[model samples]
Target: MGVSSGGPGTGLLDRRVERGAVDRVLDRARAGNSAVLVVHGEPGIGKTVVLDYAVRRASASDLRVVRASGVESELELAYAALHQLCVPFIGPRLEQLPRPQRAALAVAFGLREGPAPDRFLVGLAVLSLLAAAAEDQPLACVVDDAQWLDRASVQCLVFAARRLLAEPIALIFAVRGPGGDPRGVRQLRALPDP
Candidate 1:
């Protein structure tokens, strides 16, 4: 994170590596490819600044950006953060999903009464929903404060991220805090940097 001159995070200084990685992901999305990036750092390190930069750039390129931030108070609530990220597509988009996926999402979001849906179905539904949303335009999902996200939401997002293929979508996450999931963070850290 660098000092902000304040416009779409363009003012950020000394962040070429971070910015380049973000640009590559956006470029891939523009080319109808799927990409995922996880921004992890201690608090106050400009993770948000980089996210803002990605949002601005993606928007400029006509990508539909959906954003969500984990709430500490809602950590106990299953699917809370995932719900925020999916809210934009829940209406018409939900109809595009397969019957099983639609039903799973409906139950997960508490829109219907049913037994707990299968976990794999929920993750697949999210992936299907996002892929469908990108049919008209590339999609960008920005999730900040991921360390505080509910376990279920994190698992679903991670599953979706790992399964993305040929969809014009970008999934980015910003995770902070020492109390976060060490295993998840370590796996993300293992991902190639740039």
Candidate 2:
């Protein structure tokens, strides 16, 4: 099914079938477990509707939610998605990260001058930052149209997703799929029309 552009509520038609998976993800996050869920389907298959449901549920449960969307035009810009995901959470909490990790993120975000960052280092920095934030409250990071994300952002985010254990954070990606799959992440493919 496709989402309607009229407004909220109007677009989430026929999405009951996807509710269970979203509930499970939210349940895991509430239990202090780290989780990553990828919801993939063909374009206009209501993936955004599912993501919106997750966001609403997470917010209702008091989880801190951070959202970002990848623009096709920004696909060439390194760390663009990561910047969007982490900018609101950046603050004194980032100072708690290991020195090198801190520097890596700063370099990537243009917050300071430094050598080009290692992708893994940046990813670890992201993981640490999310974990640190989670200590204050459970966190949910939502990325829409992840298929359009930059290569570097995808690498870093996937790295962070793989390492999310024992932390109260949930990383969710809504990607245009049915053909493309984000490597090494747990996937929940949406059903195609009959």
Candidate 3:
């Protein structure tokens, strides 16, 4: 089977079945509602493809998109995934964060020196940063291969995902599954090709 361009009559096998879910996420962001979508499937089952589609659609709709892929080799490094997601948003607005939150993120990113940060504090800081960015435009945070994320980054992301109410943000995680489900996030399972 070949991947389609997510359009009709293109003589391609579009991921029509998955489009609705992606649309719902985009719709929610456009309406200033926060949403978290977890796309789970085994390796080679198009989880990355679906994420790519969502990224394209989001960009076309003018949403600010940030993406991070968990590297198995970096699993032992603290805050690596979270740092990747924050890089684009890490300018002067970061200074607007509460002092503690700012310090925590700076320390995590190695942009400052400090004792270890509280994990929950780092999560809240991230949520605040994303919310601030979305104030100018809707924002989408996409993560692929989430199962390989460091424990610290995963904990922070999961905390932010659970508490994203009333923000114009969408959090999408695509994980290789049949295992490795992140608790408390909505799951969108990709159906196998017939």
Candidate 4:
């Protein structure tokens, strides 16, 4: 699950996937610019499948991959995206946050607070730091169901994407449009073309 899809291209469905967009993204990623890929379409339009294929292809090329999903139930927490980035490493040394903030986040997500901003920041910071630390490898942050992202998490991700432009990191947000957030679409369009 950490490496290549070990198939012909991105994967089975990739044969039918939009190669131009995917190739453009890969080409730019190889050039050291992080991409904010938004796969927007009607519901059940296979956005996730396309992104999965892209990610698998990227992993085959030795890119480091991190995956997360936004949930409708927890849309107000400041770091839902961050938590998705950190879940694989949840454990000790992560429980040190201010109770109010922790409880608010925990209750929203139905998870116990580890600590105040410490745990939350750990995932967010670590992802960025990993990009900074790896000079030869590309970092891929695959965020699924992005339309469900809370305001805070969405803003944080936008900020993170801007910072990753200075590093070897690429972001792929699988979004469902029409009913999705217009602001998110506009924000992504505003990113400097790299």
RMSD for all candidates, in order, please: 4.2, 3.2, 2.2, 7.8
Report lDDT (Cα) of residue 84, candidate 3.
94
TM-score of predicted model 3? 0.92
RMSD of 4: 7.8
Question: Candidate 3 — which residues are off by over 4 angstroms?
Answer: 1-5, 8-12, 179-184
Greater-lDDT candidate between 1 and 4? 1
lDDT of 4 by residue, 1-194 (tens): 22333354544342233444665676677777766667666667667766777677678777777788888887776677666764543432134344453354454344764544443443345444445544657777778888888776675566556555556666777776644443432222211112
lDDT of 3 by residue, 1-194 (tens): 65666675434356676767887988898899998888888888888888988898899899899999999999999999999999999989889999989999999999999899999899999989988899999998999999899999999988888788888998988888764555665688886776
Model 3: lDDT equals 0.86
Give the best candidate by lDDT. Answer: 3
Residue-pair clashes per candidate:
0, 0, 0, 7
Clashing pairs in 4: 95-114, 95-115, 96-115, 96-116, 97-115, 97-116, 98-116
Q: Is candidate 2 or candidate 3 better by TM-score?
A: 3
lDDT of 2 by residue, 1-194 (tens): 44543346645655665667777877898899987888888898878978998898899899999999999999999999999999987889678899989999999999998878988899999989988899999998999999899999999988888788889888888989653555555788887644
* Total clashes for model 1: 0
Model 2 scores a TM of: 0.90
TM-score of each: 0.87, 0.90, 0.92, 0.64
Sorted on TM-score, best first, the list reads 3, 2, 1, 4
As a whole number from 0 to 100, the lDDT of residue 85 in candidate 4 is 64
